[model samples]
Target: MNRLRAVPKQRLLTSALLLAIASPALAQVAEPVSPSEATELDAVMVTGIRGSLTSSMNLKRDAQGVVDGIVAEDIGKFPDTNLAESLQRISGVSIDRSQGEGSKVTVRDVGPDFNLVLLNGRQMPASSIEATNASNSRAFDFANLASESISGVEVFKTSRAATATGGIGATINIKTARPLESEPLANVGMKAVHDSSVDNLPKPMQGGKWTGEMSGIFSTKTDDGRFGIALSGSYQERDFGYNEAAVGGGWYAFPGGEGPLANADPAVNATNPPGPGDIYSIPQNLIYAINGVSRQRTNGQATLQWAPTDTITATLDYTYAENRIQQRRHELSTWFNQAASQTSWTDGPIAAP
Candidate 1:
């Protein structure tokens, strides 16, 4: 399985040394640190990038940050494969995960809604579902952003930055890679991934899942040297299941002269009226709950770009995503009274009719 694990104590110290020397935090671009100052003998290093197959394949034992910015490949070395997952490695960052998966990112224990997410330096859209069960507000669905097309990610963890003044927690800026130098070729590519497990749910529950994605890009320059056109599209699909636990029925009433009796006297009979010996009680109903949840999701997108002049560019893009969930739930209650038949004046076994 493609999974990320927490950094071990030994690896933390070792990887820190390597990362401190190579990470962008100490690099010359965003933050400058000379080799002398980064000469830590013990430090653990982990990559921040997760989706660059080419970059990851070409990584050297000591290679670090790139010239452009902080790529996911730099953070990919740790166990995280998602934005929130990778961000958790950063100090003071927390997450409200779902089913052990990265669902939302929180900084310094602050709620996710307090944070902001940006795509290509612009606000995308917020999810209508609340981050918690309390209010109508919702969390930003970071999963909607395409990680494969991402070139780099910038995080403004501090509140003093002008660009991050919109939100209190932090601001996440996701950037897509543009043409390296105005390539004229018709670039087309596709990728697919599948995941399966025996027991995705609790005991007596088992299932499997698969997901795939395809995307392409086409660009060309007009002969007049003043115009250009580009087109792109992408599609994706996924399937998964869910499970839960519950207990039912807290109280119950028993037979009595009027309603119910507190204690069993065993000394008096029915002629005694609503006194002692009129009631016997224990946990009334022993019930068990069974619930099942399954869902399927699909998303498609198309984009167009045209540049009539060197400094003027116009672009149009549209995306559609749909998800369906099929769920089945049931509950059963069973309680046996070892003596539901026999009856006696003094609470003794009745005659064997």
Candidate 2:
């Protein structure tokens, strides 16, 4: 009976210990760090803030973004230079180029429309949609947005700052020089350029070559008053050339076929080719053509800035562009006879036996 009573006491103690273990509040608690330790962490955060501020200020002072910037003086030194070519130096920038040297700049693999390219902080309106036609592609002409008109260009890579809020891919800002508040003076500039294709293919116009540009800047203060007016304008033209080859192949449907090859065969005449309303073989190498494209563009811009006082300013700007693109293409093909000995080439002589 005494042993049985001891057992009951032991069981009671065990149950109480288990209950305490399962209770969350009774578990061990960790102590918070002391004031000195917390202060040490604050120091690290302050250092990081200072570093970031320094970087931001540097970017602003240089008239650049964290991503990139290009100055007009730099562009003046290169050959066949243009706005798109200048912007290509920035990291992550690419070009949506055609056969011609002319192209639109792309940022970080994004489409040209995704970017917001501004002239003096204002959006430039598009002149056309077809991009290749000068009359149609005039809205974003590189010539109208002259490299000379730009004092500098800034490419914003990220939207970390308030100024970079609207653009997602990137913002290209073209800065223009400010008119002087003091005595004004006139400045004049002229430029000429020539470009020839490296392909060296015989062209109707000898591989497309051309040159043209005119520019002037005038500023003056009233002889007796503080009022001043300034005007600047530029005009340029270029001839672009390109050669392109295109290859295309598509499937052909046959009568009572499960898959595309159910009744497919290389047996057909050119008179009734495989196309809509017909069932026939699809020749892989049916047509081969080389096309030559040439274009001439005339672009110009005018800007006027007025600063009556040190803090008051006004500006007006305009752009005009025209392009004419012409294309000439010839398709050549060879047809082999059933005997394999008779061969005929389009635009070429065939020996008849």
Candidate 3:
């Protein structure tokens, strides 16, 4: 009976060891994992005017040279219609509006001739048909480019090896938006403008009419975010005018007691001399001028970007801009001449067509 009891005890000891070995495997398969213990992820999203301001500040801070920049507030919007007008917000920058519109930029007291303008790191063709003196130097016509097609504008105040040579005042670099910069972005805008001067003018001037503008932008990227494309277009028309008055031609001055002509027979002579004084002449011409201007502008841009890997990027961009301007001037003049006596005068008002 004692031998039988020892065998039973040995079997119990073996079973206990087996149970201990299997307990760990069962616990591993039955326990559940909490979702909070998973790996962490990161995301970034920016939009609106605040986003544009932040992006512009970042660009200025990270630039290798002294630079100022302006970023678009949205898909197809800039601060102003004329690029030069927007640039005036920068320090030490000024603009010239000879044609009643901001057409040239002057940086740090330096004229536009010394400043260079670049379109995507390349020199753009010059258009000066409406420029003052028809000057086509290094300056660019800001009116030709529509603000909606641009993504950003950078003004380089200091030179760098990577930058193009030739700007003493500043180098302007205009950049177009890329599709990868945003997620399936699209925008459209239209505006109708009325000019009081043009609308209130008489019948003939009424032809100037009202003005309008239309602009749009579209951007998309591939599912993998490796290839992208952006397209933008804008059309604008404006009618404006200027009114001016001035005095024209020669002047006649005499000492005390001396008349304007010094003679009465319509010719200068000693016997018929009146008096010597500086107050007799009323013989001169007065002029007035009315100028009217009309302009039409169209701008478009297309950009394609390809990134096969995270470390490399390739881009192709194309831009087109056209501006047509029409101008007309009408002048009216009046002449005053000496008649009977040296102190006498005649008046004739003449209109020029």
Candidate 4:
């Protein structure tokens, strides 16, 4: 009979082993993935202006109250040298310039005195060269802070109980960079600025000069990724000039209640009789002034961070800033006095203290 020969045991075993090794089911099983590898795959890195815009949008979307923000384009790089100038880009925000440089910010219809400024999360001291007024009393001088030392700025229009309570306008929070947020980094920048307003004046009146600014940032982390440090500093100097015309002294009303006088009232023939006037109010004093200002700013910041465990972190931060402003004013003033029956003029130089 054509009976099949007995299958060899070794051949049968070898065929079963080959089938197991080549099976699709065996090949479909995946190896376990490590947490670090998975995190890397999901991480997204962004940079430059677009990154700043993206970050700002995210902050707005996630904030609990009405808020706006500006994020730095990169390490030590902000949208503008003046923090007030940068805030002007936000809606409902306005800025006042000092000698053509942004120095103060106003939010909505609220004045500067109604706004509060915080460094990091704590209230910082306020300062200004202006005499105390509705706008300068509680206003922080943005010109004293350096853009290079800031990582972002946030303005909170609506407040919660946890929020700081000084501002009726808005709360401005300045954020600084941290070392553990990135890998080793270094950035240095220099800028030269010229002001045409003062530079184009006559030789004796020209107070404008080429202004220079320098800024730098350095950051690094430990090999174990548990400790980090960051340092930033900036310096700037500027010279500028401004001119003003003003009228002082009370206006004079014509006799017989005819009206105010533009010049000495002829009808009042008293030796002086309200100086010079026609039918409109008379200007008793005329003043012209040219002012020169020189200003310098120095700023610095340092931060250290440590994470001893996955759930524990500690940080230490320090900041310092100094500003100096010197002003000189030249004035030519004319005075008309009916009481003294004399017209006088004076010219002199005034130095600001």
Candidate 3: C-alpha RMSD to true structure equals: 11.9
Tens digit of per-residue lDDT, candidate 3, span 186-273: 8899998777666534456544456898999999999999999999998988887778788754434444333334434545333323
lDDT of 4 by residue, 1-353 (tens): 23344456667899999998789767578677877777545677878899989999999999998999999988688888888999999999999987777988999989988999998888988788654333436789898898997889999998867668988999999999888876789999898988766753456766657889899999999999899999999899888877889986543333334323334444553432332232223466799988877778999999999999978889899999988778777889998654433433222231110
lDDT of 1 by residue, 243-348 (tens): 4443322222334343223344555343423223334333344666554444444444444456676787666655554544454445667764423233332332
Off by over 4 Å in 2: 1-67, 74-80, 127-144, 160-166, 181-212, 219-230, 250-294, 331-353
- Candidate 2, 1-353: lDDT as tens digits: 99989998999999999988778754446576788776443434322335434543555676533657654432122223467776777789876555644467778887676777777777766543235544533225453455544556778876645463455678877765444432364656676667665244455544345566676656565564445555555666555444544433344443344424344444522232333334433233345555545555554455556656767767776655565656555666654333232222232122111
lDDT of 2: 0.54
Each model's lDDT comes to 0.50, 0.54, 0.78, 0.79
TM-score of each: 0.48, 0.55, 0.71, 0.73
Estimate the TM-score for candidate 2.
0.55
Ranked candidates (lDDT, high to low): 4, 3, 2, 1
Mind sharing the TM-score for model 1? 0.48
**Worst ten in a row by lDDT for model 1:** 344-353
Clash totals, every prediction:
27, 2, 9, 12
Candidate rank order under TM-score: 4, 3, 2, 1
Question: Could you tell me which residue pairs clash in candidate 2?
Answer: 127-139, 134-323
